[model samples]
Target chain A: MTQTLGITVDNISVTYSNSRLALYNASCYVQPGSITALVGPNGGGKSTLFKSIMGFLEPNQGQVDISGLPIHKAQKKQLVAYVPQADEVDWNFPVSVWDVVMMGRYGYMNLFRIPSSKDRRLVKESLTRVDMMDFKDRQIGELSGGQKKRAFLARALAQEAKIMLLDEPFTGVDVKTEKAIIDLLLQLKDSGHTILISTHDLASISTFCDRVILLNQTILASGKTEAVFTEENLAMTFGGIPTIRNEERGTRNKEEKISTIGFD
Target chain B: MILDWITEPLQYGFMVKALWVSAFVGIVCAVLSCYITLKGWSLMGDAVSHAVVPGVVVAYALGIPFAVGAFLFGFGATVAIGYVKENTRLKEDAVIGVVFTGFFAFGLVLSTKIPSNIDLFHILFGNVLGISQEDIIQTLIAGFITLLVILLRRKDLLLFCFDPNHAKAIGLNTKFMYYTLLLVLALTIVTALQTAGIILVVAMLVTPGATAYLLSDRFERMLAISVGTSLLSSILGVYSSYYLDAPTGACIVVLLTLLFIAAMIFAPKYGLLRRSHSTIESN
Candidate 1:
């Protein structure tokens, strides 16, 4: 099989029915086997961009091409796995963790067919990878925040996709769980899967992501971590509000003074 | 005593046919109700059931089989409600409340307007005591088709109900899934109306499923348990009503309610009363 990897966004723009412009002529290419962090402030179109790329939302202009296939025309959608924000799901729904993870194979399983032994094995392996094999039979409503995130991650892993789009996978998780998840993402990246994550945490961007796309409705900056995390670019992306600047307080102060940007 | 009640009812052909029809309707509604409960569309089922009343009244006035008018008007109401929910800002419950009540009230007014000696109570609360052979055959046909559709689309339907976002991500036509489910629901409601009436159909569709939810964690098991409980309730209620000379629909609803209360108290893990008791014990 041909290796389907890499995604190219060419001048993509999106607007909602309420006449709110989300993305404006945004353009970027996600290289194969790279971990990219899409970082932005609240209401910065990060989720919108993710949704457009996933073909859930149609762009008003330009195009999104995934592995030489237009996103709209992509045949093997099973190649891309998406883990939506936990808050978007209803926890009270009567489903087990295993049941949720098994859903990842729905695309591959025949419409009328039951899960085969191979599918079961894959589900088990995915759960084991997330160290959630013990909780497979547990109800989703009874899980902690971190456990819920892990279970969702297990579902994505069961998809066996080449690209994973995770929306704030580490939000509201404990420090240990956060580190574990980040480490797992790095391992997946090393194993030749492309991972794109959206996060509000700038501190982890430099250490965890190979490239960072600073987004505030559009691509404010896209490059290596060191280049995109500049104090000036950070100030601009965050609307002149300084991010937590414990380590780079002097640098941010100097940049603010030089740039004459007012911070409320 | 049990043999006497069974033999006495068996002697009457209409009574035997009524029991058969109720059994078939009970099985079909119970199986489909699993999906309705899982999807949180119990109220939608209620709305569809009530909306079919106007159509039933119209068909009676036109000297046609009540099922024809009921199916047409029932399906029309379902489509109208679906369109309103998708196109308007009105919440689904509010839309359902308005549509079903409007149609049912219209049905009541139309029933009063007609000079025919048709007993309106028979239509509102099913006359299981007077089921004809034709009714039995019709219920059987509807039950078979509903079961076939459900069996064929079981996996897809399960995935759609549990995680629609993931279903959409996999390129499944989620809009088709939604409409297909509503279509099946309409069919089930129409078929069940012959045995349980509109008011009691909600109990048949919701109570068994809710009880099953409290008992099982797996979809297949939940569906199986719901069908089992519904069949048991239908048989017991029908027999009890035959012996005691009570309303069959009311008896069935009462039986279902008792089963639900029992499940709430005794079922493990998901049961509310059980969970509360366990919490108190642990504390």
Candidate 2:
């Protein structure tokens, strides 16, 4: 029997301690082997949804099932690897790039057991995949912003997880590093790894993503990249605010325009 | 020089006992502080050290071995800080500040009210010269146990410190690891109080680890460097205090501070002075 990398969200909702509802009755299914870009304005519940899926937060009213296992269950966490925003880590922490990547294997290795030769090899391979092998011995604090993000990506890649949830992986990264990361994600998708990334860069959405999930407190729309990027849908998803402008028009206009664009 | 110092100290049984006790405390605090410094819990040492004062005062008032009272009080303070940090919006440092200051102030008030026979200065600044043989053996046993526990759980403790999220995702009990670390820290601080005193215990807990951090990125190397620095500083400080008629705890802390400053200037990689020099050379 063929196995499916499935993510089934059933009526999930979340409310912060200050009594603000971050998510409300949101539901979506992530199909296997695809890049799904979750895009929205800041504080629009994108990160909250990703955390909920990773079982970091208990939904106030719904369930997330991944590969037949519930989010809260320990077995399900093994199937999903999460790359949190790089800014969340303390760079002053005394550790090398290799050490950080080795942490990815912690989920598979025995909790008290030392990493074996195989684990070391996997760390090296992951670093090499990110083209960071030359700087393996360098401390995390010594790396640039883009390098730090790539190192985190290598750490997630080393987890060998079936599904990867990345939050703002391309934020503040230079275009070259961003393209390299997107290329790596594309390769991973081709290799049957389900990838979901939360991002704000609408320009790269069509080029890098196979599908787009536009969320604003709830799932406004989710479908093929071309179908979901319509001007009307973008305005609705962004709270009736237009985000794109044609430079050829020379001046700003509030009038809505529908344009067909190919992936760059 | 080593033989001369060893023989002269061994001639006086008390000196020999003091040296052994200091060594024991040095080893225990050195190993335990590696974890504390790495996890950014260096300030917890200061909290526990000051928290023990009230326990020591109460025990002295009751005419008992002060270690029992101090252990209970120090461990209680640690737990209180952990509890408040978990249950309230207060940060860890704020919780520690409230808990330690309350206990320390209570101890200070009690010291002033109690009989003049017990010297308040002696309690605050420990007298390594007056260490009893029983104290030496007790500290050795505690140190051995602390070392064994650290060695056995080194991997788990390291994982918890570096990345707790990954530790949890791996099915490791992160809460258990955190509390276990606090317990070890409390025990280590209580043990070191015998030799370094409450005022200087933080020096033993923080200085050597911080010095090691400047020198190495590998955890194992850092542990070794910290332990070595602690041992060397303890012996040198004790000998210098004996010869120069200085306060032992102060002498030890001063020596540790000097070593830390030297490492900050001389060590490669993360050292500030070294980095500046390298930058100049590159330019």
The numbered model that scores best in TM-score is 1
lDDT for each residue of candidate 1 in B1-283, tens digit (9 for 90 to 100) = 8688668778877777777777788889898888898899898888888888888778878887776787788778878887887677787888889888988898889889976656778778887777666665666666788899998997778777877877877667788888788878878877887788888888888888899988987777888889889988888888888878899988888898899998988888767777898899999
What is the DockQ score of candidate 1, to 2 decimals? Answer: 0.42
* Model 1: number of backbone collisions: 0
Interface RMSD of 1: 2.5
Query: In candidate 1 chain A, what residue range of length 10 has the lowest lDDT sum?
Result: A241-250
CAPRI verdict (incorrect, acceptable, medium, high) for model 2: acceptable
Off by over 4 Å in 2: A1-4, A8-27, A57-63, A75-77, A144-146, A172-176, A239-264, B1-7, B57-69, B107-120, B278-283
For candidate 2, write residues B114-195 as lDDT tens digits: 7645567776888788866665565666567678778888877887887786665545677788887877777787678778
Clashing pairs in 1: none
Q: How well is candidate 2 docked (DockQ)?
A: 0.35
Worst 10 residues of 2 chain B by lDDT: B133-142
Clashes of 2: 0
Interface RMSD values, listed in order for every candidate: 2.5, 2.8
Off by over 4 Å in 1: A1-4, A8-28, A57-63, A70-72, A75-77, A240-264, B2-8, B57-68, B105-119, B281-283
List the candidates' TM-scores in order: 0.86, 0.85
RMSD of each: 4.7, 5.3
Residue-wise lDDT of candidate 2 within A20-44, one digit each (tens)?
9999999998888899999887888
lDDT of 2: 0.82
